[model samples]
Target: MDARPSAWIIAAVVTFYMSAALVMVFVNKAVLNSTPDLPLLFLFIQLIIAVVLLHAGALLTPKIEVPPLDLHTAKKLTPVVLINIVGLVFNMLCLRDVEASFFQIARGLVLPLTISASSIATRSRPSISVSFAATIVTIGFFVGVAPEHTLPTASVPSGLSLFYGFLSSLFIAIHAVLIKSSLPFCSNSTIQLAYWTNAGSAFFLVPFILITGEPGNLLALVSDPKWHMSTLFWGSLITGVFGFLLCVAGLLSIKVTSPITHMFSSAMRSVIQTLLGVCIFHDVLTTNRLISLATILGGTMYYTWLKSNQPPAQSQRPQADQEALDNGDREPKVGWQAPDLDEGLNGKN
Candidate 1:
């Protein structure tokens, strides 16, 4: 068990962290207006970049056997796929409704929601005491906020953003399930599923892009120096390719650490993003927003702490747990381009 940080892991972290900082700068400049078409470009482009980096990273250890998950169990994977579709919708909604720093913060809901999903899916349901703890955490989160919530100006919530975000959270939980179910698929490799998920999303989103005339003014944004082209370019490159991948790696590496712990660890991305939002974009962390952030964090902590005390489920657990779970679903093969592991890892592989 190599405890040392890999070069690729370091690269992934820097890419994702810096990307958030740059995006905040662009948002503050008002360069990211309502339905900024550039975001779409960023999404698609990052997907490509991440895949490229993953492939290149794989080359360093070409002889290593890739442990593709045993996805032959359709009963396990079918439901997961259905739910991942929901995740894409939620992510899109987050970008659409509560964008900028708020999205970064609110998306933390994925933590509690993912934990909720895991508890329900597993035999050990969240106990009444656990539920109460989660509820208090949730309550504490919003206690500091006033009744009046200041909605995002460009993308009004319509209350739908919350719904979609919640839904996305659920699917994300299921995606984690997919990771467990398909654990054998990506083991022993730097697997990335976002590119394929983005490919799937592109299929759904392309029509909307065409129908809404959404290839909007991207060229104009690019040529104009006011938009922080340098930042955007670098952000897209690092974040799209490396940041997201590293985030996934962290989650996978620490799988047995409890779902809440998994989520809380991952939530660092949101915190960094929010701080960046304030620093770069002048996005305010209002009373209501602060409460919301608190609530989400509280809930996430409650879940992780509770779950961590219990014995971990053995099925599809990560290798790092030092628990022997078979991720070897396929005959070991050496290659750079890994078999698609993200297909079931809730599109997050």
Candidate 2:
């Protein structure tokens, strides 16, 4: 029984995942730009919508079963959920502040950071090629954000947005490392983990929403006669639906492709995302920023190539955990692209 997926199927899966992912970013950016003051509220609504959709899917199909949640398992998953939500908050804040074209460059260190976290987690030293690639990525990050750089008005990503991007990358890296350890609590099921993390994240968000006074902001936004309710309402709905679709697309991508193929698809997504951001949002794309993207992409691709060529024992993620990385189906969703083990665990390889 040959189990290889057909080439057309792979192409279809990659296209679906990329399209959903790209749309997710643009839609979220549109909403964030419109309601810059309500990042948490926006994210809270998306989470709720995704949760509702998951519930609906679970009820309709055997493929989408979510195990019942209990206090014991919840306690075990608390750290994962905490990391997930924190990563999400930072990602949203970063997106809220930066141009969508610059967003990927803003978070350019994700590959290297993930490598660092994975190294620490696995207690492994990356090969010289991997270390060199990390250096390239770091250099690209600096080049992209060089001091006194000029572009269109308000084009420079603020220091705060860059800081948010860094923190978001850091938390995402940590989540990638820790999520493997956190999976047994969910019976090694990514679907179950998804339910627990999203539901728990949404549940835990209420107090913060209150503390941040987003509820009041929501009221003001609603009462503002000049504001278009339809934009906010419809934008949220579209992104939420695409967010769920991104999860399913991600799952399909994983089941049908190798990490190397997935890495290439991600590279393509980054390119398309930048182009689309310019076309749709009129984002400024400076020369240095372009160089920064190419350099970072080169380094990550080199890392992926190196890791994939290594012996399977060293290069491959543990089967159970690998599934969770791509499983927007799991905790790290939208805006946060968790590097595959091929890139993240280059140290281990």
Candidate 2, residues 14-109, lDDT tens digits: the string is 898777777878888888888888888777787777788889988899988878878889888888777777777787788789888777743466
Evaluated at residue 220, the lDDT of candidate 1 is 68
Which window of ten consecutive residues has the lowest lDDT sum in model 1? 336-345
Best by TM-score: 2
Stretches of candidate 1 off by over 4 Å are 1-35, 63-89, 108-112, 140-160, 186-212, 216-232, 266-276, 289-349
How many backbone collisions does model 2 have? Answer: 1
Q: What is the C-alpha RMSD of each candidate to the true structure, in Å?
A: 8.4, 7.1
lDDT, candidate 2, residue 247? Answer: 50
On the 0 to 100 scale, the lDDT of residue 48 in model 1 is 55
lDDT of each: 0.45, 0.65
